[model samples]
Target: MIRYGILSTASIVGRFIAGIKESQAGEVYAIASRTVAKAKEAALQYDIKNYYGSYEELYEDENIDVIYIPTVNGLHYRDCQNALLHHKHVIVEKPFTLTSIEAQKLFDLAKQNQCFLMEAQKCVFLPTTLQLKKLIEQNVIGDIRYIELKAGFPGRFDYDHWMYDLSMGGGALYGSATYTIELMQFLFDNPHFQIDGSCIKCPTGSDEICNFQLKMNHQILVSSTIAMNVPLKNEAVFYGDKGYIVIPNYWKSNHLDIYFHNGETKHYDFPYQSEFVYEINHIHECLKQQLLTSPIMTPARTMEATHLVETLYQKWQEDTNE
Candidate 1:
């Protein structure tokens, strides 16, 4: 079994711990936090066999087959780099790095170390998403021309939260919009896209809302809007010449609806388990196959998403500066 070491006691870690409990191929072998008390508390809560007060201790443990990082967005690069350097496979949370350059560097390091590395993007592994991919590939939506996606929630975070800290890689583009960006990339199978957009920033300098238009090869137009100050439909729709597919809560979808111009409507339903389970299982399979990265959530895809986010943020910064 793959022995998994988690690098933080962040709230998100609980979801992954549950995923580990549900999977047969791996188990929570260790957990680490900046404080011994916190580490020990989490270890007891999860019944982990080993607990460390520092990430370095987990990295130095030879028995850990993989490391799962759910730390703050800003720390992802450093932690991932260290884990790879220590020869441990890593599964890092989304918004893998603050920039494409950092993502490229981490990917290169993983290659050099011959270790597995993946962005923990659980949405792409959802059964509904996989099914949607199949339908799109089968021309269920013929020759996609336009795509619209939006994700947002009502504003609730305080000023001091990392989500509002620019230095922490906090913004609607990175925190909320990334799901749609990555989903669009996965669904369209296109990494080459351009963005023209604008953003509204919070007082703390992080983006509160973003509206962007993307144009891909073949003149595919994708419009996306993400915000933290308002509630949106949080859905994605693909419009084709023959029909359209609509997925609600596309990021963690379990069902979809298809409508045709000819007045035919079809609905598909899927079982819903924690989406994390699918990602965890995919990682387990990749490890078994000795693969360096998951084909579903590839390094190229991660870089593409990072590049888009960085570009949008830069554009926002420049606009704000002037």
Candidate 2:
């Protein structure tokens, strides 16, 4: 079995471990945290065989073939770079890095080390998403012309210590933008796009709400709204000449509905125990064949999406004098 090492004790790590188990193609062999107590606690909680107080030890472990980084937004680059330098395959959680340059650098470093690397973008791999993709490609909706998404949750700064710190890559821009941006990229075959957007920051000077519009290929228009301090419909819609599609909770969606102008509606659902399993299993297959990069989650796609987010942040930062 491919041995996986986790690089954080973050709450999300538990879910990642569960996906690994469900994949059945890999095992959570080791985990690490900044503190021994936290590391040990996580190991026991997750049923991992080994634990380390520092990430370095886990990277050096001879048995661990891969590392999963679900660290904070700012640490994604550092952690992924460290793991790759040690010749370990890596799966860094989304918002892969704060900028396109960092994303590009990580992909280059992975190639240099001859190691596998990918962003943990679960949406593109879900059964429902894949099926939706097929339908779009087949023009089932008669040529998609516009896409819209509104995603957010009521998140307060008190509970999330790092979310308001820009230095820590905190903000709705980093926290919530990539999913919509990359989802557009994946669904549209990585089309050329330009972004125009703005954000309203919370009291702590972090973006809590962002509304961006992407002109895709000078044809399709993708409008996105992301709010971290408020609740939204959290849905993505694709409008076409013939009909429209709605995916509730597109991030971890199991179902979708399509409405046609002809007054017909279609619904679809593909339930699963854990959405993470598809991506985990995907990584398993790539590694088994000695592939160093994912074909679907390509480096170019990551860079393009990152560039979009960085550009928007820069624009707003200048306007707000940040």
Candidate 3:
């Protein structure tokens, strides 16, 4: 079994650990946190075999074959770089890096170390998303010309959290927008996307809301909006010539529906225990074949998403300067 080392005791770590246990390919053997007390608490809570006070110590363990990093947004690059230097296969949570440059460097580092490296963008590996991609290719939603992704929350986030600090790469664009931005490239088959226009809000130190109107060179229009403290519909929609497809909470889509011009509606469902399992299993299969990069979640795909969001953030800064 692949011995996985987990970083941090973040809330998401619990779900990830549960998923690893569900998959037969890997086990959460070791974990680390800034404090041994926190690490020990997580170890006891999740039944992890080993715990360390610092990430450096965990990365030094020879028994750990892979490391799953769920660290803060700003720390992903440095943390991943350290893990790769130690020759550990790595899977870091999404928005892989704050900039495409950082992402490129990490992918290059992985190559130098000859270690498997992937950003955890699980949506692309989801069954429902795969079904949607198949349907699009089959032209069930004939000639998709426009796509819309909308998401947000209804309450204010704590200003003290790392997610609210722009210096640490905290913002709606880097955090929530990662899903829609990357999922678009995946569904559209890794096309080059260009930003046509943008409207970003920065009520706090970080961007609280972001809007981007994008165009694929093929003339496909993509519209995306992500916000904090707003209650817009949290879904993704594709508008086609014949019909439209809707996936509620598109990031973690379980099922979706298509409405036909003929007044017929079709539904697709993919039941699952933990949504993280599909991505984990995909990694397992890749390792079984000795592949360093995930074919589905390629580094280029991640860089594209990072580039797009970074561009949008730049637009936000330009607006502030104006």
**Lowest-scoring 10 consecutive residues by lDDT in candidate 2?**
152-161
| lDDT, candidate 1, 1-322, per-residue tens | 9999999999889888888878877899999999999999999998898999999999999999999998999889999999999999999998899999999999999999999999998888888999999998999868888999888877667778998898897777888667877887787785468888888887898888888988887478889988889999989899999999999988888899999989999999987556688889999999999999989898888888888888878877888789
Q: Which tens-of-lDDT digit does each residue in 79-157 have in candidate 3?
A: 9999999999999998799999999999999999899999998888889999999998999879989999998874656
Report the Cα lDDT for residue 273, model 3. 85
Off by over 4 Å in 1: none
Could you tell me every candidate's TM-score relative to the true structure? Answer: 0.94, 0.96, 0.96
Pairs in steric clash, model 1: none
- Give the CA lDDT, 0 to 100, for residue 265 in model 3: 98
**Location of the lowest summed lDDT over 10 successive residues in candidate 1:** 184-193
Which parts of model 3 have CA positions greater than 4 angstroms off? 196-200
Candidate achieving the largest TM-score? 2
RMSD to the native, candidate 3? 1.4
- Which ten-residue region of model 3 has the weakest summed lDDT? 196-205
Q: Measured by TM-score, how close is model 3 to the native structure?
A: 0.96
Clashes of each: 0, 0, 0
**What are the runs in model 2 whose C-alpha is more than 4 Å off?**
none
